[model samples]
Target: MPYIKKDFIERLIDRVDIVDVIGARLTLKRSGSSYMCCCPFHNEKTPSFSVSQQKQFYNCFGCHKSGNVLGFIMDYDQLSFPEAVEQLAKEAGVQVEYEESAGHAPEKKEREVDFYDILERAALLFEAELPRHPEALKYLHDRGLSDDTLRRYHVGFAPESWDYLIKNLAGDNQKILKAMTDLGLVNQGQQGKVYDTFRNRVIIPIRDKRGRTIAFGGRVLDNSKPKYINSRESPVYKKGHELFNLDAIRNLRDKNLPYIMITEGYMDVIALEQAGIHNAVASLGTATTPEQMNLLFKQADRIIFCYDGDAAGRNAAWHALNTALPALSDDKQLQFCFLPPEHDPDTLVRSQGAKAMLDYLEHAESLPEYIIATLRNQYNVDDEGGRINCIDRAAEILSLMPDAILTRAAVEKRLADLVGWSQEGLHGSIDDSIEKLRARKAVRGPESTGAGGSGSRMDPNTIPLNPMRAVVARLVKDPELMRAIPEPDKLVAVLREYANDRCQVLLDLMGKIKANPDTTTGALLEKYRDSGKIGDLISLLAARSDAAIEEEGFVEIKIIDLMHYIKAILQEHLTARKQALRIKGRREGGLSNEELIEVQFLETATRQLQPSRKS
Candidate 1:
């Protein structure tokens, strides 16, 4: 085995505090000297996961899963050892320094920090400019925005000068210019640098849930071609993936709030919060995304989508509903609300008091009711054809849900009532819709393969010549197995005789393990540089646990299955080679004597390796 670095491994583990790590994800209360919370890893009615701050470890009595900070991150975030270490290091403010025997170590760039710093500097500059710039000051005053509101939202202004931000930083001019360009603050032109991005506009700093300014949205004071101009998509700013006012709402999330109200624009969110409703946010000039939904799920138990009562607003609400269905779970609830016609949240709050709005939200109809009402208004469902169309479209939407049994039944009963059809007839329609959904799923399922190599299946016989899957499966199950397979070269030799592209990754991992046999699972998984293959490796390892259970007390079946799989792969390879030879023979008239002898030797080897086929 390669030499294990005891000091580095122990140091990495020591740096992480399990209590703090687990506490961040769950609400932990003190129980004696330790902290306890209901395990997030499993659904439990009572607290079972315990964190011992003294020992720097956590144990779940329910699932019997126990580990330190590294294990917690690995299980919770699904991160690798190295990734968990890096995360913990960041959390603990510890810099992990490593040395290599060969070549110079590559210097790490703090891209996230650089982006945040540049944005912070830019925000400060913009805030300074707002007071000095006459046009910017006039614009805010014209909008009737209060001085307190401006300060509360941190509203600022970017000057019209092209080199305004560039000259102020006084650092590397090129580096500053590139950073601005990266943040979409400036554009590169054919003639020279041009200020094609934000200029002479009121800027609103877009923050993440952590209150870090990740990007910005700027709106023109005057009648401009594009009324609102947002920061171009950057490394930190994903317009669809983030929501405005999330930072503020996150602060108040632990108040046992049952739901959060989602508005149509930033102003609506700001106005709602100022009106005493703090749990409101707006999408960044775009529809919500799955990532945003996931973030919301982490905070609130329910979401109330508040859109304008106009046709466009209803359409936007429909789009959000469709995007949300696949992600909606039993624990999460989704509902929709619309303001009075021609009124947004901002206008409504001014006209109707916050109490009236809150009452409306409390008594608002569910999403299904809103959807049905909207459809009925659009199409007259009194007619037979119209009723049929409504059922068809509604069924299509419901089918997208992974577990819509109750929802489907409710919709079916409603449809039967509307269409004046029998309950049995509506039941039959739902069955048909379910069958259609199943057919669609089956068509999209992974293709199957046959032994003949002519069917429309992914041929299991043609395993790639990389044993990464096998190697990772074995390593995760029993890292001590590395003692038997000490060298990567020898492991490769064993793997090359079989099929599985994962073997290549496993060989690379083995090389690392041989160098550091004491390497923890966290470390091994973290150093795996290729993300494209990591998921596959993880799935393979997870599958091995089941395979191990099945193999217990039936050693012969395991060996036979492995041999059979290997033989099938070899057969596929040999078949392809024979076909290639036949094509070459057609081109060159016939095979040479030496080529024929080689073919005979390959055939003999294949025959010796082929396992008997049994029923």
Candidate 2:
């Protein structure tokens, strides 16, 4: 591991061009002493996100996300402090000097350097083997990969014979062979014979973020089990700690828009690049870890979790969601998308055009949406007990959420509606259950939040109506009003009904617009042309574009007053819930000493909300 010094970080931050870093991703218009743009952190049509050049700081007035350059990168791009600093330093062409400590002594440096040198030399030898193998060359041509792509990615072929690699390391150097074994590239047999670890496979070199090849991924051309074999973790490469194509992603990071993607395979990422999507990466064969997520988020504004569409794929996505939820932020977006069943991105793009693949991405569901889908897929949502269990599952996962009240409330409401419960009933029930679970966890030890769903997993997610359709429609008509779409909790008050649930695709459209400000209604119509009825609605809206966008008579509702109306209704639900609790207490030997205080608080709160609810 490379140790970064505090002094080095301070100097890097002082000298780096933050404007250049941020401006490269999105267009920033000048606004007096600062730059202004739409806040990428949340849904908005207004330019509330601002950066002060003089102060070298950024703050979104709407979302209230503020920070200096380092903080900005960490929040918006999802990077760590040290990674952000190193990225800046590399751009500035400065050598990063680390402070020496007892842990990082000078004596340990030279041996590590030799390990790196051996890996570099071994990569060169692997590259040389490609031309010598005609079958491997044919495979590359069959994939339609250009020579430039092959060289750019450092594609290679390892021979089928066991001794091929060990035989040709320039001078039969045993010292190099010993180091190769230590790196896990060669194996010593039970009889003490040495042979290559990766043979009869096409080799794909994996590099560290700094652009040095540290490991390899071998794909078998013939029908075989374990189709892909990655390097065993070594001193230079840590398993589940490195991302494939990371070095290439770094080269294109600054120029792309507010997002990048994470795929499950090496070929998927490479295929995406060939199809003009340069901002993507893949995790090492395992599921994404918290450490890897931190590194990935720092590189872009949003992350698309693209995987296969099989049973294994759904389970993988579920695990990714559980691991990611504990760290979920209000503004950091993670989307889940799957390729058509029986096809990976590589084959999918080959058969369909890149636009078809992109359209699927544009139609992908958000993390909350995907979680609901996955949970629902496993349960019988039409049954009463099934619904309770699904919500129980939701509570178990959501209790780990860091600090997102509004977002959590919105999700809980949606979950309740799916199970045919009134929002108030589900809210009270889930809250009681969640508190009980928390107390249990407090007394016991921490349990693992793994691929296990609370009960049998629910069914795949169905589209919940964005009940705020009447409101969302008026906002979508203006497009500009989307900037004021309120926080999620308030937004949920309008979206809790399933009557106009089909309108959600329209609501999801706003996210696309926020990511790409130049997006037009016509573009959206074409993008969702196959989305059935929603497509027809957008088509009609596109046809009367003049009236919806240019004309003066479109209904212009007072959104603030509407939101206040929704807030009042929510408060009434709470008041009713508290009143029920008191009534039940009276029927069952009166309120407890602890319950008395809660009853008092509710009485005061109910009186406060009565006037607002009446409004």
**How close is every model to the real structure, measured as TM-score?**
0.67, 0.60
Q: What are the RMSDs of all candidates, in order?
A: 10.0, 17.6
Runs of candidate 2 exceeding 4 Å displacement: 1-112, 161-175, 256-259, 443-615
Model 1 lDDT tens row, 334-362: 88887788788877886786887898788
Off by over 4 Å in 1: 1-14, 23-35, 39-45, 48-87, 96-113, 133-148, 170-172, 422-424, 441-615
Q: Model 2, 210-319: lDDT tens per residue?
A: 77788899998876978899889987788677888887777665454567778888888888888887877888888988767766655664888887899888888889
Query: Candidate 2 at residue 396, lDDT?
Result: 81
The worst-scoring run of ten residues by lDDT in candidate 1 lies at 449-458
Model 2 worst lDDT run, 10 consecutive residues: 452-461
